[model samples]
Target: MKISTTAQAGALESNDVLVTVMPNDQGGVQIQLETKRVIFKQFGKQIEEVVRGKVSEMDVDDVIIKVQDKGALNYTIRARVQTALERALASGTRD
Candidate 1:
C-alpha cells in the first residue's frame, strides 16, 4: 500500500500512543520514534519492532511513521499504527 497523505491515530494520554503516518517519496519505510527517556533505554527496540512489523504486514513500501509512546502496550501500538495507516490509505488517490 502507498501512503499519499498524512494521517494519525491514538493520543498522548498515559498508557496510549500517538501514531502519525505520511507519504515517503524516498521509496522506503522510515520511522521516527519518541518516548520517555527511561523507557526508551529499556523498550525502545521492542516498540520500534512492533511498528516495523505492522508496516511490513501491511505491505506499505513508501511511508514515514512517527510514533510518540506514552507507555503503551504492544497491542495498543499496533492498533494505533494500523488505524493511522488505514486512514492514510483511505485518503490516498487511487492508482
Candidate 2:
C-alpha cells in the first residue's frame, strides 16, 4: 500500500526536472514530496536524499518520497521528477 504526504503543492516552478527516487523502509513505502521557489537551503539535501534513495526499484519497486524544492536548492530540481514517476506508476503518464 503506497501513500503520499502533504507535500504536493511544494513545487514552485511551472515546469522543471525535480525528482528523487529511492526505496522504502517501512512495510510499505511512503512518498513525501513538496516544492517551493525558495525553501530553506538546508532542506535541499533532505529532498535529494529522499529522491535518490527512494526512486529506485527495490525489492518490489515499492518506495516513498517527498520533494520540496525552490530555485535555490538542488532539492527543487527533483520535485517534478518525483511527480512524473508518481504519475507513471499511477496512470502511465509521461512528461
Candidate 3:
C-alpha cells in the first residue's frame, strides 16, 4: 500500500508500461508516468525532471496507483504516478 523500501531503492522495469528511474542528486526520488503517445511521452520526460519527493514526503505511505489510460492524459499521468508508486510499494523488490 505504501512505497516499499525495496521499490524506492531499486531499478525500474516494465513490460507494457515504460518504466524508468533516476537517482536525484538530492536524497529524493521521483516516478514518471505516461501512456504510449508521442507528445505525452515527450512531456513525461520533463515531468520527471521537475517531480521530486521522498516517500516520507507523502502524508501517508500507504497507497498504490493503477491508472487506466488511452493516451497520456494529465489526469492519467497523475494516476499512473500514484499507481506506479503503489506498485513500487507492494512490489517486494525493485528490479
- Provide the TM-score for each candidate, comma-separated: 0.94, 0.30, 0.36
Off by over 4 Å in 3: 1-26, 30-46, 49-71, 92-95
Model 1 agreement with the true structure over 1-95: per-residue lDDT tens digits: 78889999999999999999999988888989999899999999999899999999999879999999999999999999999999999888654
lDDT by residue for model 3 (1-95), tens: 23443222212233223333322334334344444576455665554432333233343343322222344434434443544455554564554
Pairs of residues clashing in candidate 3: 1-63, 2-61, 4-89, 64-86, 65-82, 65-83
What is the clash count of model 3?
6
Q: What is the C-alpha lDDT of each candidate?
A: 0.93, 0.46, 0.39
In angstroms, the error of model 1 at 25 is 1.4
For candidate 3, the 10 contiguous residues with the lowest summed lDDT are 7-16
What residue runs in model 2 are displaced by over 4 Å at the alpha carbon? 1-14, 37-61, 69-95
Q: Provide the lDDT at 9 for model 3.
A: 22
What are the runs in model 1 whose C-alpha is more than 4 Å off? 93-95
Candidate 2, residues 1-95, lDDT tens digits: the string is 23232223243455443444444556554555454535435455565564555354322245555453434344444445455555545442221
